[model samples]
Target: MPVFNNKDITLHYATFGDKDKPALLFSNSLGTSYQMWQPQIDVLQNAYFIICYDTRGHGQSSAPKGPYSIEQLGQDVIDLLEHLDINKAFFCGISMGGMTGQWLAINHPERFHHLMLCNTAAKIGNEAAWLERAQLVRAQGLKPIADTAASRWFTPSFIENNPAVIKQLSDTLAAGSPEGYASCCEALAKADTREQLKNIEVAITVLAGEQDPITTVSDGQYMVDRIANARLATIDASHISNIEQTQVFNQLIQQYLV
Candidate 1:
């Protein structure tokens, strides 16, 4: 129920674990809330001070005008850290969140000790594809994409076996404001961090989903190849690899952070 007051926007955030522990910030993907990291919080709470926040245009955060930039998103994180009097924290982001992480690691290098990019890319999709999706969501609704979100988010086998998880995520996605979701789509459409990879000097770990169609393993490798002190790990899951392969995801992060 806590919120960080930015100049133009109000961001909703939650924290777990003790204040004395090292800080870890978690950012969510498009169409997801901070709740998406519940599984991670469950395991990491004992070892780290876990911070989770809803991105602008998603969850309870204020959604301003259309088409937010990665820089804006990254700055929000900086603002949040400043609000909490935090100097540095370990940062983890997936999909849209990862794109924001790239911006932060490149422009605000001192803000993070380690950066973990999960199932994301420097440039997610082509300009045309993201634009089209944005238009579709604006004209129709989140339901249009939420209907097939499971397919994009998880493997067919995982979807078949985990109906409840699929339902829960899809519901959350569908509940998002169409305007907010579409604005984020426009942000992703124009976001191209490929050129900034070399600027990231912090220790980095990039994980990709083997079965993911949205952000594949190849995308992860592309990042690791460009960033110094970076390595790529492949998980046997889809775009939402953290959820589909929770234990493996947690173990990889725990090992990498330590």
Candidate 2:
């Protein structure tokens, strides 16, 4: 676990594959860390410079109390890229990370050659809803709200077949810093990339899970319709579809990259 200082925050990062090849940076969801992309890392690293890191307050990264905006989160990516001297690369993000990708592509379109957006939306949900949820979590704790969140993130059938996977991912939510998680939840509530989505002219792959309850296929469809050259694919899992359906998720992403 190597750490990079971006002045404001230190990012905990790890890499795999050839450094000479074009890079692929993985930005994770609100409750997740870099490890969420484990399924893709092993397969894609050989061909691409694969980098994954915990965001400002998630995983092993330093947690700075923030009422952070989407642009600020996007700047975190920019800061890290400059730190590593990475001028251009492919950008991939999931959920909260996907929101950051929207920011990256909009703010630094020239820096990204392609985009991979998984289980995310331009506007996740209304501000009132997320703020309410944040307040509830802050007052009641994550475990009390975990079951409801799990249901929204995974399918009922998935919940039946893979209890252990659900439990593991849910546990990650439990370990999350309340302040960090709540702030991100608030970010999602206020996030609106509709105008920015229209501005994205680069090739983008909007991948979603057919069974995803959080960011629905409908959300991905909106992205596909908005971005000029965006293509859409539907996997057979939930919000954390890549980990939930590794082989299928990896294959779809691999095909997109090729």
Candidate 3:
């Protein structure tokens, strides 16, 4: 329930484990909240101080206006770190969060020990598509997106077997703020770090979903090829690998953080 204000925005964040432990920051994807990281937290809390926060337009965070930038999303993390008085941490982010991690690594390399980009790409879908999606959400609300999210987020088998999980995530997206979601869609529309990938000095581990149709394994490979000190790991889940392949994802986290 802890919250912090960064200028005009208020971000909701939660912490686990001991402050004395190494800090591990978790940033959620476009439509999800900090709670999306629960599976990882349940396993890793004893070893690290985990920090999970909702992005500006997601979760309990304040949704300001429209057309947010990747820089704004990245700066929010820096502000959160400053608010918590943490100088350095291991960062993990998925999809849009991964995009934010790229911006952070390129712009604020001094603030992180390592970064894990999961089920994401340096440049996601085209600008026109993102803009169109933003417009669609703004016009029709989140139901349209939420209705089709499962197919993008999980494989058919996982969705069919995990009905409750799918419902929770879908419902969360459906209930999310329309302006906030659209604003972030606008941010993603302009977020392209392909040219800037080579500039990232901080160590990075890109986790790709083998079954992910949104951000493919090739996207993860592209990042690893450009980054100075980066590697790639592939998981057998779709876009939301952490939820679909929890044990394997948790294992990878522990492996990299060590």
Which candidate leads the pack in lDDT? 3
- Please provide, for model 3 over 137-158, each residue's C-alpha lDDT reduced to its tens digit, 9 standing for 90 to 100: 9999999999999999999999
* 92-200: candidate 2 lDDT, tens digit per residue: 8988998999888888988888889999998987899999988887787677766666787777787888888778778888887777777777778778998778988
lDDT, residue 103, model 2: 86
Model 1, span 213-252: residue lDDT tens: 9898989999999998899989999899889999999999
- Regions of model 3 farther than 4 Å from truth: none
lDDT of each: 0.92, 0.84, 0.96
What's the lDDT for candidate 2? Answer: 0.84
Worst 10 residues of 2 by lDDT: 141-150
Number of clashes recorded per candidate: 0, 0, 0
| CA displacement after TM-score superposition, residue 239 of candidate 3 (Å) | 0.2
Worst 10 residues of 3 by lDDT: 1-10
| Better model by lDDT: candidate 1 vs candidate 2 | 1
Q: List the residue pairs that clash in candidate 1.
A: none
TM-scores for every predicted model:
0.98, 0.94, 0.99
Top candidate when judged by TM-score against the true structure: 3
